[model samples]
Target: MTALHSSAVTDGDGDGDGDDNGRRRELRVATLVAACCLALVAVAFVPAPVGAGDNIASFWFNPEDTEAAAGDTLELELVASTHGDLVGDGVDELAATLEYNSEIFTVTAIEHERMLADGDSAVEIHEHEEIDEDSGAVTIEQEREPSGDGARTTGPMATVTFEVASDAPSGNETIEITDAEAILISDYPQGTFDRDAHVQIDGSAAAGASDADGVPGFTGIAALGVLAALALAAVVKRRD
Candidate 1:
């Protein structure tokens, strides 16, 4: 009877151990599942870097080469582009000025173009002018404020018509954007304009639409972010 009792005790201990091990395994599995869920949530909600692009922006007059007879009227475009991505989201305001030779040309008119960004709905604009004759500087300031909804990344900024002076010099001259003493007003704490953006640009004989080259590997990353969200959703559905 003692031997039988001992056998029974041994069996009971073995059974208890088996049960405990089973519970541990179940707990480990639960922990793993929970970790995976948290990963998915993070993937779905985490915001990607605001601009996965070069963040490079250029504002310049189009048709870099433009020419006309003295005293003739000349029309030109001022365009702004974000090389790879749309403008940053935090930006709510923008202001830029074009500085040129007041002795060579006189400002005739300034007009707003389509939205600067591709999908932007509304951008309020303010056009201001200052002509310094003694210094031979003509400043045309264009201010843009995005609506609460947001602004697009790139597009035509304005149309500037100039009346050339009858006695203007007969040679190519610059229609420059202010960057040194005066600056390009852009938000994100108002970044200064790049000389590189306009480095290749020059006022030409018949100004044709042109663009400054954008640095590669700096394209907008909106697509990557969207993919991350979609991957998270797929993982969640697979869990079921």
Candidate 2:
């Protein structure tokens, strides 16, 4: 009887120790999983370093793409955005050359936007614009007078009006910004930039005018369909 009692106590103690070890292992695994999850969440919420994100200031074209017919007039704005942060505490001066296909487009005029003024009534702006159709280029240079007078904002740097050539062929063309330079009020040069405006032309109207006088503009496929419709009507009439 004594031996059985001792064996029973020993077995109970062993079972209790095994249960305690199992519980400890489970708790350790749960804690590790919770810590891993927290680390992942913290990493996800961290912000990206500067110059690696969209927070940087830049320039681009408004209406990045457009469609028009031959002889149509289109306007494109040179857009500048400071993104409310560094690299563009607002630009005090801008200079860029716009390049296009002279055979497809002609520059009609250029108008500067009051980006430099930025609602500061004390600042005056001096602007210069030039267009060379033969070279298919337009140049714009604008600066705030009494240089470095700040205008911390974003807006159009300029608006360019273009006339599609009367005989421009159908397809897509592009206008690009080049030799670009931007200056901040602090005399700091800006290097961030974006460019290019795509223009899609519908030359079917021009083709129809040349193919048939006083006829409505029609694509080749449309003209063929009409011819097929006429032939079907004639065949039905003959059959009747």
Candidate 3:
């Protein structure tokens, strides 16, 4: 027969006092075990998004790519569209580093959208730095209105402007943003997402090189010059 450890019976001092104490200990243990089981059952019934792993929000840009000519300026906007339950601690701050092809564009300026400040009673701080040592990169940081009494968790956050280099050549270049972090007013940090941007260079010298001729502009002109010089040389040779 297997030994029984159940609280059904126990050897006490053969006195009622010892029996009562042993019974009390067994009752407490049973209560604790029952309470743990109930708690676990409650958690198991929780619904979508609230499911432990799916609770999260994200931040990204709209119109991830842009087309502009040399000397032209363009804007990129950032937005937050929560994916799961649309539940979040509400965003309070954002800090990021943006980079681009220095030879193709220059960081002109940036500003926070008013949408991020609609009901915030606290003052918002907006700051940005152009990394002069690295002409192709800029660092931006913004502290939105504080959480309580009206904080925003979504919508346009900011606009970054880039001026195409006056001498930029044709083709595509990447506008990279890194170390991006969005902090909620509740002090929680959003940890998962991706953001990207690309610039398509056109016009200016690139235009002078493509739109001028039925053929590729610059190459056609160079080819014509060479053929003309050859024809001239042939005429001179025949006369000799």
Candidate 4:
């Protein structure tokens, strides 16, 4: 009877050890799965490259119009409708023509190239130079040519970016795109330049205007906030 009891105790010990091992394996798997899920979620939050049908030709300034004292700098953005192939070569080639109160200012172009694989967008600034009024006809040209390597067979698309100093002649200023040009891919949809033109003034420029804090324009920020909340919730659930 003593030997039988000893054997029963040994069997129970073995069963408990097996159960512990099973539980440990399950926990490890769950942890690994959770890690992979987190990695995927991180990738999802990354901005995707602009693809076909993405509007790259048109550009606009946020708040469209604003009022500022002379010498005040307004941060403007050149937003592409799509993250199209044209970004590979560069975005600096695009030009901006600012006309205020008949005084024209041409800003030197700056380009920020983004790699599609990395999901990064580039920014180009046209700030260094300002063109004064031109009595002769001023030709605003966009000399965008694809690399002959055929890598850009789909053609490239991008927008011009620049800032406008409130140096207007202290009066109601009217800004308009005197002209624009772009390279087009025969097969792809050719984006219209007409949408790329506009002007803005301070406090009372247009019906729809927002401050630089991006208050009224919260689309991008709102999306990111929602995604962050979801991720936080996932982490809490996993910990529990």
Best by TM-score: 2
Question: How well is each residue in 73-111 modelled by candidate 4, as lDDT tens digits?
Answer: 444343333233444422323334544443323343433
lDDT of 2 by residue, 82-198 (tens): 543254455677788899999988999898888777758577889999889899999999888766545666789899999988887688999998877667666666666777899
* Residue pairs with backbone overlap in model 2: none
RMSD of each: 23.0, 8.3, 13.8, 21.3
lDDT for model 1, please: 0.56
TM-score of every model? 0.48, 0.60, 0.57, 0.32
Sort every candidate by TM-score, greatest first.
2, 3, 1, 4
Tens-digit per-residue lDDT, 1-240, candidate 1: 455433233335566676667778999999999999999999999977653322455666676665577668888777665433344342333456566667667777777665433444555655565656556455545544543433435666677787777655456667776641211233343333533122112244333222323554344566678889999999999998
Alpha carbon RMSD to native, model 1? 23.0
Would you list the clashing residue pairs of candidate 3?
none
Model 1's TM-score against the true structure: 0.48
Query: Total clashing residue pairs per candidate?
Result: 11, 0, 0, 13
Candidate 4 residue-wise lDDT at 49:
72
Give the number of colliding residue pairs in candidate 4. Answer: 13
TM-score of 2: 0.60
Among these predictions, the greatest lDDT belongs to 2
